[model samples]
Structure formats: structure tokens, C-alpha cells
Target: MESTSSEYARFLAYGNQLIEVHIGLRDLLADLREGVVPAAELGAHCLAFCAAVTRHHTGEDTQVFPLLAARDPGLRSFLAGLEHDHRIIAGLLTRAGAVAAELRDGSTADGAARLRQELDVVAAVLETHFIGEEKRLVAVLNAIDPSVGLTALTDQAVEFR
Candidate 1:
């Protein structure tokens, strides 16, 4: 079995990757707001970000959370709050997705601005969610069922891969 700290270290590493992606996506949003990004680039980035977020949330909802909840009573209760945040973030992305499609089809400057605002909302809400998750659950995650949580995370990541 992997050491508890190692499993948590791996989990935090994944969280850090998402954080990096969000930072990049946030910069892309800022560029869109400033009208600095080429429309083609902006549209492409938005599509990629939407896809990335959907996959990330799917992994959490389907695989990771369930595994964590099995061993930790704490995690099960926290799922409600986490899922709520997920819904909010996903809605922001859905709205942002519409704006991206408009931009791709050659909408006006306001179209891009609208998407940028939506993306900012996603960034803010997701950042808070992610930070809370790390503080409240990341370390304890390793102590949850490693055979379950790690295996599920690995299997789901393969499916996602």
C-alpha cells in the first residue's frame, strides 16, 4: 500500500495541475475582455477550457468523491457542498460555452466580453471550491481507503486518458 502521505501528495499534485490550468484559462479570459486575443485563438481556448472542466468535474463526481466517502464520514457530508459548487461552476461554464459559440460564429465585441465575465465567475467560484477542498479534505484523503480511492482515481484517469 502507498503511504498515506504519498497518496495525498498525489492528490494535491492533481489539484495543482487544475490550478495551473485555471490560471491559464483566467488569463485567456482577461485577454478576451481586453480584446487582445485573436478571435480564433479565443474561441479555441474557450472550447478547450470547457472540455477540460467537464472532464475534471466528471472524474470527481463519478469516481473520486465516492471512494473518499466510503471511508470517511466527513467526506460524505462534504459531498453536498462540493456538488453544489460543481453545479454552480458548471452552469457558469455552460453560459460561457454559449458565448464561445457566438464568438466562433463571428459575434460582436460584447459577445467576447460576456464570455469573459462568465469565465471570471467560473474562476472565482472554482478557486474557492478548490481551496476549500484542499484545506478540508486533501490530507485526509490518503487515510481514506487507499485501495479504493487510489484505484478508482487510477482507473478513472485511464478512462479519461
Candidate 2:
């Protein structure tokens, strides 16, 4: 089994990756807001951001949450809440994606305005969800046995697509 310290380090690394991607998405959204990104690329950028978030959530739901549930039944409710947040986030992503697809020519005043609104909703919810998850599970995750590794938690193979 991996030492608790080592596992904690790994969990922190994963958290950092999540932060990095979140910042990247925010930066892209800011560019979109500034009307700098071409309309043709907006959809792709949105898709990438959504994909990353989906992968992270799917990883938690399938790999991390299950383990946490099995290890501590008391966490079931908390995990369920996180899962609910995932669904909400997924819906928000879908909404944003549709808008992005419509922006094929470049951002218009109305489209940009609408997209900003959608992204704001996404960002608000995601910030809450991410913080709640870290508060509730980061320590538990770090204590998991090294034998039953958490590689799956950080894996992107099991997608939400």
C-alpha cells in the first residue's frame, strides 16, 4: 500500500491538474467575451472545456466515489450530492455547446452576451462543486491503499461522452 503521504501528494497533483484546466477554460471564455476568438473555433473550445470537466466528474463518479462509498457508507449522501452536481454541470455544458455551435461566424453582441451568461452559471456551480468535493473527499482519497491505486480517478479513458 502506498503511504498516506505519498497518496496525499498524488491527490494534490490531481487537484492541481483540475485547477489548471479550470483556469484554461476561464481564459478561453474570457477571450470569447473579448470577441477575439473566431466563431468557427468557439464550438471546439467549448467542447474541449466541457470534455475536461466531464472527464473529471466521470472519473470521480466511476472510480473515486465508488471507492469512497464502499469505504465509508456515511459518505453516500455527500457523494450523491456531488453526482447531482455533475448532472447539472453536464446540462450547463450542453447548453453552452449549443450556443457555441451557433456562433460559427464570430461572436455577435447578443450571442456573446448569452454565452457569457451560460458560462457564468457553469463557473459558479463548478466552483462550489469542486470545493465541496475537495473538502469532503481529499483526505479520504489520500488515505486509500496504494495496492488499490487511484490511477483510475485521474484517468480520462472512461469518458462522459
Candidate 3:
């Protein structure tokens, strides 16, 4: 019984950490969208945000999702849906990064507007994805075995530049 409780605690921590990472990513995107980061540095900031999000999704796809799917066959379809979101997000990030680069290079007269649009789309999709993930997975994650080392869930902490 105590072992089961410990497992719940450990996996719950993983779920909480996942949400924390998502929040951090959202905040970074908000800063970029709001022009909180200097105009000159917007390109660099956008790239950094893109990288952070990629790392987080990659970690979940490679580590967390596999473990969960293996533990519960029922999660396979749900995990696949999340993976689909990741692919869509990856495309959006690439588009945003290209716009940012064009802006930095002074090659696009409307780069800022285009970037903002891309960011808005990214933000909307991300918000939906995060909410669905948190709602569905927190309870599922809380039931995973504690023996599955927490390191398996680590996504290399999100870094802000």
C-alpha cells in the first residue's frame, strides 16, 4: 500500500513538472508576442522559444509517452494524438522561425505582422494541447510505478535567453 502511494506521488510530480514546463513555454511566447523583448532581439528570442518547445515535445514523445503507452495500452491512441499535435507545432515553429529570420535580416517589410500571426496560431494550439494533456494525463501519470526512474521523464529544463 505504501509503495503504491509512493508511486502515485512520484508520477504526480512528473505531471506537475510537465505543466510547469508548458507554462514556462507559454510565458516565453507571450513575451515575444507582446514585444516585451526588444525588437532587435526578437529573432533570437523566438528561436530560443522554438527550441525550448521542441525539446519539451521531443522528450515527451521519446520518453514519457512510450512509458505510458507501454504501461497502459489504452493510452496509445491518445498519445498518438499528442504526437500529431507535436508535428503540427513543429511546422508552426519552423514558419515562425523563418519569419523571425526574415525580420532580423531586414528581408521582409511585414515580418513583424507575419510573425505575430504565426505566434497567435502557435499560442492557440499550444493552449488547447496543454489543457487537454493536463486534464487527461495527470491522473494517469499519478498511477505509474515509482520504480520508473524520474530521469526517464526529464526534458532537460526549459531555458530562457
- In terms of TM-score, which candidate is strongest? 3
Show where candidate 1 strays beyond 4 Å. Answer: 1-36, 143-161
**Per-residue lDDT over 1-161 for candidate 3, one digit per residue giving the tens place of the 0 to 100 score:** 23444545656777889878888988999999998988777887898899999998998888678767866789999999999999999999999999988888878888777888999999999999999998898778766666654433334422221
Candidate 3 or 2, higher lDDT: 3
Off by over 4 Å in 2: 1-40, 105-109, 145-161
TM-score of 1: 0.71
The sequence of per-residue lDDT tens digits that candidate 1 reaches over residues 51-159 is 7777777777876677567545576778878878888888888888888888777776776667778777877777788778766655564344434445433433322
Model 3 regions more than 4 Å off: 1-10, 145-161
Q: Give candidate 2's whole-model lDDT.
A: 0.68
Better of 1 and 2 by lDDT: 2
- Order of all candidates by TM-score, from best down to worst? 3, 1, 2
State the TM-score for model 2.
0.69
Best by lDDT: 3
For all predicted structures, in order, the TM-scores are 0.71, 0.69, 0.83
Q: Which pairs clash inside model 1?
A: none
